[model samples]
Target: MGNSKKVILLGNFGVGKTSLVRQYVFRKFSDDYMTTIGVRIDKKMVAVNGQEVSMIIWDVAGESTHQKIPNSYKLGAHGIIYVIDVLRPSTYLSIEKEISSLEDLLPNVPIVKVANKIDLLTEKERIEIVNNLPLNDYVLCSAKNGSNVEDAFNKLAESLI
Candidate 1:
């Protein structure tokens, strides 16, 4: 065991924040859409630079605007996993605004932008979506099929160290 870091998942409703946390921490995914009322916490150990780092994940309930999230939930976070659904442009249309709000709350916190539910899209579609997204760097993941899920968390863990 090694030092632990606090990480948070933030995004709009139904963008798969809970699903990503479930997959990363438990290696399981479900189609059921259980709305998170407040926040769900989970822990996972990841090896980064040959050192074990415990990742404390706070899966906060999604809000239309990041500003609406409870300030208490945003504090003490070492990293942020900002997720969006590839099928919903509306979810990410205000990406700059959302990210800006996060930055305001947690300045200098490392953020891993993620596009979840990639399993629902074709390979070409995935590439196109990534290209069109405003983010220069992000992970394309599928909680349902377990693609790039580990890599995403590993990247965040690495940054924490």
Candidate 2:
């Protein structure tokens, strides 16, 4: 394994990508809607499966028109956490398109499908969405409550390592 792993947080605007990162790393939450102007970087040392791992988490800007993330960002990423809002069906629908684009840019890199805001969905609705996906790798998470957030990161780390 590399000395450090690069992971990118990807999703559409207003889908809680930043909120998920903030909650995971800082354990805080807010209801504000601020567009991420550029890539925000955070680092943490994690112990995954008994080995120490350093994570260089790139919280990529959500704005589609913002060109802050250069093409090079996709080159070195070991894994990607593709987040989609469970409360917003359109965001869920767009996951495939986003994944396609990512694969085109970085084929063969592992991707962890994250259904964020799971706390807002009922069991039936959650099941419906899960049943319809490609089902390679996925996690149901709630950044607001810290549910399954660590598991999502751990799963990605496990794959990368």
Candidate 3:
């Protein structure tokens, strides 16, 4: 492995942060909705572009724009996986504010805007929703179907290196 890097999954409530992490770390998914209390940590080893890397994933409890994000959770994070459920408009709203918060708290860390739960949307709908996001590039994924789950993690690992 090259190096261990701390990466976090952050987004609004019910956006599938735990699902994404579970699918990536364990290759499993459940339909249950168990809200994360503070933060759940998981680690996965991945080989990215011939470099092995350990991705330390911090799955923080989801919160809305009205709620305050914990800066303490952002410390030591090398990358951010800002996940969004594509079927919900409210999850994607306040994206700029969230990004701004992350940037302010954890500057210089690369972020992968992940559009999760694509399984709930048709291909056209997914494309349209992704195209309309405030991000320049993002990974469209489905934790339930295990779609692009590794890719999202790999993208983050690549950024860390």
Per-candidate Cα lDDT values, in order, are 0.89, 0.79, 0.86
Q: How much is 87 displaced in model 1, in angstroms? A: 0.5
- How many clashing residue pairs, candidate 3? 0
Instruction: Return the candidate ranking by TM-score, descending.
Output: 1, 3, 2
Q: Write the per-residue lDDT of candidate 2 for residues 1-161, one digit (tens) a residue.
A: 56589999887678788888888788888878788776889976788778888888998876442233577766789889888776766666656666778888888898988888877878998788677755456788998888999889888888877
Better of 1 and 3 by lDDT: 1
**Candidate 3 vs. true structure, TM-score:** 0.91
Q: Where does candidate 2 stray beyond 4 Å?
A: 63-69, 128-136
lDDT of 3: 0.86
TM-score of each: 0.94, 0.85, 0.91
Backbone clash pairs for candidate 1 read none
lDDT of 1 by residue, 4-55 (tens): 8999999999999999989988999999999999998999988888988889
Question: CA lDDT of 8 in candidate 3?
Answer: 81
Q: Per-residue lDDT for 1-161 in model 3, tens only?
A: 34888888889989999999999889999999999998899998888788778888889999885136667777888999998888888998888887887788778999999988999988788778878877768888899999899888888888888
Model 1 scores worst on lDDT over the 10 consecutive residues at: 1-10
* Cand. 1 TM to true fold: 0.94
Question: What local lDDT does model 1 show for residue 112?
Answer: 92
Best by TM-score: 1
How do these models rank on lDDT, best leading? 1, 3, 2
